[model samples]
Target: MDFKELLKELKGNLLSLMGSKFDELKDESKKDVQAFLNASKEKLERWTTLLAEGNITVSDYKWLVESQKDLVVLKGLYAAGVSKIKLGHLKNSILDTVIETAIGFVKPNKDDDNEATV
Candidate 1:
């Protein structure tokens, strides 16, 4: 898996999620992803390798991704007065994006039938 590319896609998808208002929290968008990286980088690398090597189920990978939910505070947006409900949804959405993008970059082993784990 190409981590750099995966990160790029994640940031792009995040910005897109913001639509035309993307610029509103430009630093937060960048920081959100950076925070995710700072917190999840090693784990993500290991997990992606396991995933690609057919060593873990996709569900397991997703769960592992979800475990890092605390890392993305989106504090700038929150401080900017985005509602708790909206921020909650946005947080979930960001996590979902991470899962999707990481999975997209992983070219799993052909034999991986989602029945494996380390």
Candidate 2:
């Protein structure tokens, strides 16, 4: 899987994770999302390669994503009166989207144990 393409798709998926109705949320959170993508690009590349090579599981990906929680701050949303519960949901949604999108992009390259027959 192309890392650049994966990043692009992740950006779109995360920006729309709250659905179309939350336009304000989308607009307000775009910078935060970009910031995350920028800061996480290298780490994501490594983990994605691991994912594609069957070196890591979805659970591992979730754990790695969670480790970057500090990078997902949403000052704009907080200032916009978005409740803590909703903000938490959005943050969770972002992390969930990252894992889901990575899974969708990178298929495990595991080979069959048995040899092929003619």
Error of 2 at 76 (Å): 1.6
Query: Candidate 2 versus the native: TM-score?
Result: 0.81
Where does candidate 1 have its weakest 10-residue lDDT segment? 109-118
- Backbone steric clashes in candidate 1, count: 0
- Name the candidate that leads on TM-score: 2
Instruction: Report RMSD (Å) for each prediction in the order shown.
Output: 3.6, 5.9
In candidate 1, what are the lDDT values of residues 1-118, reduced to their tens digit? 6767776777788677754444677776667556766777778888888877778878888888888878778777777777878878887887787777777667434345543322
Task: Give residue 64's error in model 2 in angstroms.
Answer: 0.9
How far residue 22's Cα lies from its native spot in candidate 2, in Å, is 2.7
Estimate, for each residue in 1-118, the C-alpha lDDT of model 2 and write its tens digit. 7999999999989778755536767667787778888988999999989867767766676688878877878777777788888888778878878887877677533232111110
Error of 2 at 46 (Å): 1.0
lDDT of 1 at 36: 63
TM-scores for all predictions: 0.78, 0.81
